[model samples]
Target: MIGMYDDVVLSFSESKAEEAGMARSMTAFGRCSDIVGGKSITVELKSVNNRFLDCNSRVPRAYGAVEERIKPYLQSRGVVRGKVDVFVSVIRIDGGETELALDGEYLRRYIELLRQMRDEYGLRDDISVMTVAANRDIFTETESGATEQDTEDIMSVISRAVDTFIAMRIAEGENICRDLCKKLEHLGALVGEIEREEPRMNEAYRARLEAKLRAVLEGRGAGAPDEARIITECAIFADKVAVDEETVRLRSHLDAFGAALSSDDAVGRRLDFLVQEIGREINTIGSKVSDVHMTDTVVEMKSELERIREQVQNLE
Candidate 1:
């Protein structure tokens, strides 16, 4: 679902999601370029992740007070999350909506109050042109403002561009998923390799322990004393630090991760959770084992998972 439009030279940026945990952070820029011709308006949307849709608008300074008018356009989009920004620039097109002058209720109230002021005290009898001009809101230029229909026309094309931007994000998310799945497959294979090595690894440790115990006894002149007791204690220590159970559990976690990737639910947040668990398991293995080569292999597995996780952050 990559965007059909060409990539415009829009400024782009990103934030590390881990720094803002549980928050799906994303930023994108899209301009309609030739969006629509409605009262000569050009609209662009800039979006960033937020817990709620907090849209702000910026228009030509002449239309400062009318910025709120743009909200009615974006409000109907049903965006529940994001700090959305809208930029509208008017190009001074002719045939714009002519504003209507008003003889509003406020004008009548003003005149009534002025009459009361004069009659009550017989003071300040002034009905000058300045008195009328002081109530500026009571009058406005005829046909001199933008129309709702005009804003709507411009928004239609801007919507197209924003939707296109969303599609691009989804397309990138798909690619990220593919690459991460491959990395997970490699990590799964490494877990299998480590599992295969564990038994032989345990045997090597047993032999080393047996030899070292004999050396220690001989140094203290007990080389041939209580062999059974020494072997039993060494076996207990080895079993306590055994990583076979941990490796098996790690494989189960990997399987769960694969299923998550293929699931219909949004997996960005889920993948992040799985990755943190994977890291914890790998760390436990590295800390429990004293073997340099085994620890090195575990580090490699973790490194690959970490790289995959960096991509997962971009998913939604």
Candidate 2:
């Protein structure tokens, strides 16, 4: 959802599960405006998910130095990763003066060139001050002096904007955390189902194998196959198809993911690693299982893990 408050726009996502306060999302926006030191300073910050911190800024040309400070200040405030854009607008409320000086020599040369063009092309002789003034290079504009106080006011507004930005990130992160937790619960349930189905699937496979062996022996008019040989084959089949190790590792990865979501520190990278590990286990199980029901269950688990991975990419 998106909302507007004065000049600031805020967007938040909704989730059905309970909110968790930990973690921070990389997508958010914040804006702040204030009148200070005879100037109206407004700072706006926008960020989106990125693998690394990329900060860019646009400020008044006279205050170009402020641009250099913005990125470092954001880093100091714990903004680790995102594509961040900073926009600043400063309007002087005080009666600040600007000096304009005419370039007499350039003006003379420009008029002379205009006359030459008119004579050469036989164009209308309609040169006037308004027309000549269109060449703004004939005038030099000297802006009022900038001071340290201006930089201070701009940084102050930016500080407030950063505070609001982080707050929004945290709020959105809470929704993400809640959604992730719900998905993790679903995945856990799927894993449990796979575990319960494993024994039955092995039993079914054993029964089919035994029936096939008995049919072959009867067709050849031979005595019944050795019982010990049948038992040994079934044991080998069960061992080959077992998913105990994969499921156990998968559960462990899920627990680590849940714990990372509860941490206050930056866990985006950690969460990504856990998701990859979980995917490896799921794929291993998928490869080992041949039962239709087990295959469908594994597919569902992969889908849920993918959802979690998408959310983790938006974290910082």
Candidate 3:
């Protein structure tokens, strides 16, 4: 597989989109820094492996929907094949506005409650300034919503941060692919060894049968035609536990696996299936190879295959 490391940046500037009143099109970007008119608003998108683009935004509730819009942006880049856990954060680098607000509905209701309480307890004052300020929704000051112009400016910044995040993930994917390929190569080598040993194994089985027949006939004069009996029993045992066809099919599957690994497409599911097939072949070998040495070798191959499977889980 070819490892790709890339970053894309698109910007929306207030001065650029002023006539439209809002940014006309969204931009997909990477790690961002926006410096405008001596003030800056920075947005960072940090993405990691996930089953999908499960995004979390660290901004005012008013701007939470921006995460949804980012979905198309990420998909457009062809980098959305795997799970991506994105954390979006917006920071006002140089603050331009500090907002204050009163919840009129909440304040009105508090006043009514104060009046009722004073009458019941015979208190002189019905309302206190401290109590009004302490009421959860009665009063507050904070950064407000993104204006049409603010969106135009902020989007430009966010796009840059996304670019940085994608670059990092691509690099990470590269490293993972490299390690995975090495494991695949090792597995291929082990399969090749089995193929080479198959002929030798057949010869060994014939030798074992002859030795067992002689041992039986040597013990008694009445042991007649033991050669014929041994040949029949040996044939039955060999047919019952033969691994020749298993090895051949497994070798073919290994070649197909190499093709899938090198393809520049969404092959995660395909590779997963191939791994299952490979596991099946190995299990068959373990069961058929009455030889202790062959069984031990199959066990070791399975261990390596398991490690390879784990690394493939993170592929895109």
Candidate 4:
């Protein structure tokens, strides 16, 4: 089996490690060719990101059973989600006898059409056997029947191609994991910054409220504002701008996201859900905090989260 990397064993080992701790990207290509059972068998695999697993195969018409087996075989190898296309080609190398015959009806019609074109358009009269035979569809090949061994040989080639395909995915996935981890760290720091500024935000709101109330009372010639009423109004303002619950939930979601990144299981869908939850908490925090600095920080957090969401879609 041929692979992109020279050290297939080491590449496979690293792939398994990525499967255990990181994520697999759903885009890669692999091709393998080998001589088996006196036949040259080649298999190619290509995949792209998709919301679900969609497997398609293209093989010789005589080997329809090979197409049926490709999908389940891929799933067995942990290809949970992607649009995967497999191609298989086989050539006999043992000097086997084969029959080729011309399609009489198709050849007749093709010749008739060529003559008609020549007559109608007064075109060149250079059409000959070579020119006519250029249309390959005018001939047919009688292929030998497929046997159990043919299926086995083709499947073996497919397995090797998949090995290299998965290794490429794992390598790309590790890079994605590193980028995601950095973004998550930034998110955690932003959450901490929000928490640190929460108390100061409440105090600022309370002071503003008190000053507004005092101004209104003095304008009405009411001598000094009632201290008790001012305290009650400030308390209400503080409660209205409180984001302790939201920030706490946001922090928890960030932690869950970090844990999911290192999980052994398929975490694409799980990470998607966590991003949604995190967005909800960030929105809540945005609504509660009116400070200019806090608002800008929240916007930056949302921007980072959006990037994370886009990156998560590439994972499987």
Query: For candidate 1, lDDT tens digit of each residue in 144-218?
Result: 565666556655655665555444444454455566667887888778777777777777888888888888888
lDDT of 3 by residue, 92-136 (tens): 556546566777887998899889989988988836788778777
Q: Write the per-residue lDDT of candidate 4 for residues 1-316, one digit (tens) a residue.
A: 1111223232356225334444788888878999998889899888998989999898876678888999998887788888999988888888755568778999999999999999999999988999998999998664476688888888888888888888877777767777888788888889889999999999999899888888888999998788998899889878988999998898788878877766667788999999999999999899888999999999999999999999999888
Model 2 Cα lDDT, one tens digit per residue, 141-246: 5447977777788888988888788877787877787778878888899999999999898888778877887788789988867889878887887788788989
Worst 10 residues of 1 by lDDT: 14-23
Clashing pairs in 1: 98-143, 98-144, 99-142, 99-143, 99-144
The TM-score values for the models, in the order shown, are 0.63, 0.78, 0.67, 0.82
Among the numbered candidates, top TM-score falls to 4
TM-score (C-alpha) between model 2 and the true structure: 0.78
List per-prediction Cα lDDT, in the order shown: 0.65, 0.83, 0.62, 0.83
How many pairs of residues collide in each model? 5, 0, 15, 0
Give the per-residue Cα lDDT of candidate 2 at 83. 97
RMSD per model, one decimal = 11.4, 8.5, 9.5, 6.2
Better of 3 and 4 by TM-score: 4
- Which pairs clash in the backbone of model 4? none
Residue-level lDDT for 90 in candidate 4:
81
Candidates sorted by TM-score, best first = 4, 2, 3, 1
> What is candidate 4's CA lDDT for residue 195?
92
Pull out the clashing pairs in model 2.
Answer: none
* lDDT, candidate 3, at 182: 73
